[model samples]
Target: MTIPLADDVFRAPGVELFDFPPLWEGAPYWLTKPVVLAVGGALVVCALAWAAFARPTLVPRGMQNAGELVYLFVRDQVARPFLGKDAERWMPLLLSLFCLILLWNFIGVVPGLQFPVNAHIAFPIVFALVAYVIKIYLGIRHQGLAGYFKNLMFPPGLPKLLALTLYAPLELLYTFVTAPFTHAVRLFANMFAGHLLLAFFSAAGFWLLHEQPSLVGAPVGVLSVAVAVAMTAFEMFIQFLQAFLFTLLTAMYIGASLHPEH
Candidate 1:
């Protein structure tokens, strides 16, 4: 016989998923789940690369094939179009960026480790800042300091009068201020919101069935679980898309830095 609690016992999920408790009692609060997951993701990616390329081969076998797929995907889809003939020069950087982010995003969907490293905000911000710094440095290197700013602000095909009056300040603000802000926020917002949605439905299911322990709540619990399952699958797609988008934007930014006139 099951003892039934009030239906109100089944409250919806809170932000607890985002607020992680320290895994060890003595550990600093900052040394939490997300940090562990971040390190784990990095190690996993590195190990995969090592295993795939540990032995030189005339033809790829096993993990090498999968590794090659990832390399080609980034090289052809991401680097080629924007970087053009110089795409090969940047392959290593772009590949690392894409794979690291993809793994971090996919961590949220993994069973027993359902956390997105990028959801923490600071992770994405750091990546955006690093890429932004590299972008500015490359721009200044390719085009002198004054030339870089001038080319960025005064795009070709614009009339000189309009370029000086309206476009210069607007371009300055857009390129310098808004671009990197959006770059960071875009990845952060998606992962944060997606994780929240998953947490809500997952908690709802648990609360509906376990907390209240009622026959009446069972159907709702089942439905919530189903929704959570569907959401996880959808989240995987989103993870891939966001990772791809982030890499694509990085390439675009670097391309812009290289050839500001374009």
Candidate 2:
């Protein structure tokens, strides 16, 4: 439940904030803000990537410089740590994931497009499922179908009896069920909660100052605005962190599939 403000008449924003109507009056049910934002974010990411990396200069400047910074960060912090020699091979996927997700998240704070694409569960689910499918496919292809399951469920050094009775079931659950579920939900939950908090404070400030202005309400309204501002800054950091973590986890999943013993 949302924490109601001190006043009873003023309603704090709730789940309704996330309930976006169709973009057009007679549009299909799926044609909503998040859908549009997700597509738009993807295009923007592509455009930026092209602008930055499509051309090269010995002394990089402008977008290329910034792009290199982001690329190097993903390579060093996310891919290299987990993937080792294979990091470059996976940079394309990892870079796209990080850039697309970071843009989707930053869109939440944009004035007109304040909806984060991943705040909707479906967006994250799609991304997570794609990554999950890739991980599974790579595991089976690289380590043969039976070998993949064997390495996953029965890691070496464990007693056969212990592996069969206890470790196997837990490994199966984590590998097939828990991993993908948490992968999507972690991103969804953070964006959902962050956007909700932002909307709540923003609405509260507006309602107090503009909708129901009063001597007492004005100061509270100002405070609410201050909090919203602070949270917006903090949320940007969280947005970047979430993107990094998501990409990192993707690398880790691929690494585990490629080298199960590690």
Candidate 3:
């Protein structure tokens, strides 16, 4: 379910009286908030790339250092371990996914940008679809269609009956349904829940301060502020964790498809 922000939650006392419009109006066709956010996020990542690597340096500094650190982290921690000898070819894709997701997740923490792009299902869905297509493409490219189906549906050390009754259907479901669903929902749910908690505490604080103008209100506001601060820190950690988890899972899936024997 989509959580609603309180009327005054995102507003400062003397800010202009522009109402927060619904992200969509008609049949959700073109240029929704999430779409705009996603596009903006892509642009931000591209800009970062240009700033970081456009000018090569022997001793990387600033954006270059940050970008290289992220690249090495994803390359060493995610792709290499999973994809083994074939990792170098895929490192760029995984690095791009990691950075994009990290940026999208952290956008909520930026002032005046109150929502994480991944909290919207559409963003995750698009990413998951891309991952799925890559997986299928890799599988088909490496193994012929016959072998791909064999690897997908028929595992080693399984009896023929068991393979037919259990493994085949399970693999089909995972390949066709569960994998993408979980991949998309994992990121979506994390951001959605984190944002909801932040909104709740922030709004609660405001409501307490405004609705109850007594000594009690001050304490409640203070408590709410504390919780908001705590949740912000927690959300920061979660933002990174979700990006790492998504990239790691994608790497693992790619690894499995590329090397099904292992």
**Model 1's lDDT to the true fold?**
0.87
Pairs with steric clashes in candidate 2: none
TM-score of each: 0.92, 0.95, 0.88
Give per-residue CA lDDT, model 1, range 1-262, as digits (tens): 0122345764445455677779999889889889999999999999999988888487998999899999999999999989898899998889989999999999988878888899988899988998899899999999999999879777778998999999999988877889889999999899988988888788777778787657888999899999999999999999999999999999998998887766
Q: What lDDT does the true structure give each of the candidates? A: 0.87, 0.91, 0.83
What is the lDDT, from 0 to 100, of the residue 44 in candidate 1? 96
| TM-score order of candidates, top first | 2, 1, 3
How far out, in Å, is residue 231 in model 3? 0.2
lDDT per residue (tens digit) for residues 132-223 in model 2:
99999999999999999889888778999999999999989988999999999999999999999998898898888887889999999999
Q: After superposition, how far is residue 124 of candidate 3 from its true place, in Å?
A: 0.1
Across 110-169, the per-residue lDDT of candidate 3 in tens digits comes to 778767889878788988999998899889888889999988888778888999998899
lDDT of 2: 0.91
Displacement of the residue 80 alpha carbon in candidate 1, Å? 0.3
Off by over 4 Å in 1: 1-7
Candidate 3 segments whose C-alpha is farther than 4 A from its true place: 1-29
Best by lDDT: 2
